[model samples]
Target: MVKFEYAPAPESTAVVDIAPSYGLFVDGAFVDPADGEPFKTVNPATEEVLCEVVAGGPADVDRAVQAARRAQDGVWSRLPGRERGKYLFRIARIMQERARELAVLETLDNGKPIRESRDVDVPLAAAHFFYHAGWADKLSYAGFGPDPKPYGVAGQVIPWNFPLLMLAWKVAPALACGNTVVLKPAETTPLTALLFAEICQQADLPPGVVNIVTGAGETGRALVEHDGVDKVAFTGSTEVGKAIARSVAGTRKRATLELGGKAANVVFEDAPIDQAVEGIVNGIFFNQGHVCCAGSRLLLQESVADEVLDSLKRRLGMLRVGDPLDKNTDVGAINSAAQLARIRELSDIGEAEGAQRWSPACELPDRGYWFPPTLFTGVSQAHRIAREEVFGPVLSVLTFRTPAEAVEKANNTPYGLSAGVWTEKGSRILWMADKLKAGVVWANTFNRFDPTSPFGGYKESGWGREGGRHGLEAYLHG
Candidate 1:
């Protein structure tokens, strides 16, 4: 039989209309920052500058917070839940209408595969709005107590991995709860958020109800430390989360932080080998393993360790890593040079610490930030790679002799965001779920997310939750 291969199926970039430069989305309009210096956001795939965006300083943040507060007091807070729901529904519908453009833009800006951006990120974002729209008029039935009140203005900071999705996760719930917001998209991935600002306007959302401030760490710090913000929601590094926690320590503000994770994908000896292998690949390789809840730690039963490793390696060899715009690409570019350097640093340290590192034979683009799917077979709990969050397409394998040992090893890390278990036995699955100390536990699947399900973390991973009715509480008070 002749071998057949897919041709390059690249998505058209003509759908997205990017501006030469962008200003901060304040109140209801795009305005230049007061004292902020401008910076260019580049595509990590080719190191090409995409566009210049204003860096929001304390003054711009204050402006945004004041606008949000004014909107909360003047219009949003007084609006009926049914009326607010209509706005959210309109936003969701408009997002659906512009879904293709949004997906292509996300792939270009974020350097994630087009398929994932199109299928997962864009749709889930719209789903959040749709889900929250339905919940807006039903908050009384929610268990958060009757006569729930909006928190006025919420300050939100999101990471680069899922720009539009995180914005939807924060903004949708806050707006649905009748609160206005000031959102800070990651400096590297602000395109979609800026585009979403246009969507809010298209939906005829009231001015100041949804504000997006784009910049680097300093801007995010300003938003987090702003005095006018009644609630703070952040999704990023654990270090930043701790700082925000301290920033609001003595204030009247409430915060929900979704931080880092070093999750374990536990595979039992009785697991269906083929299915388990698939989950193993999906858990760590999806989004180039930039996921906060990525299963970077692979806990295999010693009995089937060799078999699983063999299968996993074979499966990884088949992963296609190339242009983000290509529909056939399984993996794409890393978000930035800094992230690539960090991944390389941790990977080198893993090798120095005596873990047997292995990667499939694959060619990476010379110009872009890329790392092949890699695994360290001789890794142990003591290994740095096994303990710390690599935040890349890297997996550290550790073996467990028994069920109890697997649970102990899985929960050993300080980060307790998520964990996965694969076993043929139903009793074993439940036992593992109960035993594992994590906020989200998946039994047979991995990297699965739903807008209606509440997601957050334990310990240093995060505080509070986002998604579902649980997410609304952070933006409201009884």
Candidate 2:
């Protein structure tokens, strides 16, 4: 095999203009909160301060919720389905027009590769709007009965892993269903959300139709608890999801929570070695494994486990883990210092619990948060690493002797978000998919997503779907 070297291809950051400070986006205007100081957002890769943003408090949440309520009752609710779709279409076009700027800003704040931010995140965000735009006028045919009604004002909170993409997932469907929204982006990655607020203004969307509040957990709590909010949607840890569930229990408000996962990627003895190796690498390393449904557990049939591990290791050795702006960088920086600390702690526990850890020969930068692609072998289902959501570029290797045993090991977890199977036999693919207790199952691939597919989880992975037609129904009551 020939080893090829490439030149540095860094993306230009001149495209995006970041102000020294920003305020809460409320009622189609930027306003200062009544209390709380401004908080600084930084580039995780360089530890450089990107910008300072206002920290919205309970009062701000109330104001935003009231704004959404006003929009839902006034302009947005009275607007016809076709007119609503026209607005969505306009927003979609504006997002595409500024795609490069959004992608660069996302890379600066979130520490994901510019290649991914440009190619995957921005494009998919626009796709969600485009996909949902077509469904706007035709929503009566969405199988929710003839006269499905909107849920008034939706209060949404999203995580930091895929900030822009998650916003698209939650906002597009809610808007398409005629529900105005007050959305809170995770404190760590709020730039793109703020930028989206500008996009809403550029599209000339009616006032109060979309509100963005920038804050921490307390702000999210306020939004979830606000009486003016008719619905709630949260994407984060299971602990927080449980709290949100309890907060809205037996209430008139509706809620959808998409939480954590410890997904398993199973490889059979008859699977193609090269493709399986690629799938295994992609499962746990893409976006530095920050995905909620990432394939962190690799279960191999014992008959060929050694050979598969060798191939996987060789492939990981070639992965480039460096500057996110570089087009050739395969893996990028961790999202934040706290997340990096958590990954380190869990990995140390895995080592202490008798797992053999290994990584490719690589040098890490000293300035910022970074983690090499790591794998632990001789791991069992009983190990904490196999059961926990590490949410970083870490893989735990486990082996089973039979198909029934594989099923047993995969289903032993508390999460049922997703699982993957790799085998050539069509019959085996169908059989294993049937046995896996997950919301989404993939054959010979992992981590592939689309706007047309419904994505969610079972068990502690949380409730309700977030894509396709099922996502639209989550915001409707009648």
Best model per lDDT? 2
Assess the local accuracy of residue 72 in candidate 2 as a C-alpha lDDT between 0 and 100: 92
Model 1, position 36, has a per-residue lDDT of 90
- Regions more than 4 Å wrong, model 1: 1-4
In model 1, pairs of residues that clash are none
Q: Write model 2 residue lDDT over 1-478, tens digit each, in one string.
A: 3345779999999899999999999899988887756999999999999999977888888899889988999889788888999999999999999999999999999999999999999999999999998988888899998988898999999999999999999999999999999999999999999999999999999999999999889889989999999989999999999999999999998999999999999999999989999999889999999999999999999999999999888888899889999999899999999999999999999999999999998888888899999999989888999998999999999999999999999999999999999999999999999999999999999999999999999999999999998898998876
Count of clashes, each model: 0, 0
TM-score of each: 0.99, 0.99
lDDT of 1 by residue, 1-478 (tens): 1223679999999998899999989999999989898999988888899999998989999999999999999999898999999999999999999999999998888899999999999899999999999999889888888888988899999999999899999999999999999999999999999999999999989999999888999999999888899999999999989999999999999989999999999999999999999999999999999999999999999999999999888888888888999999999999999999999999999999999999988889988899999999899899999988999999999999999999999999999999999998999988889989999999899999999999999998998989987878887788
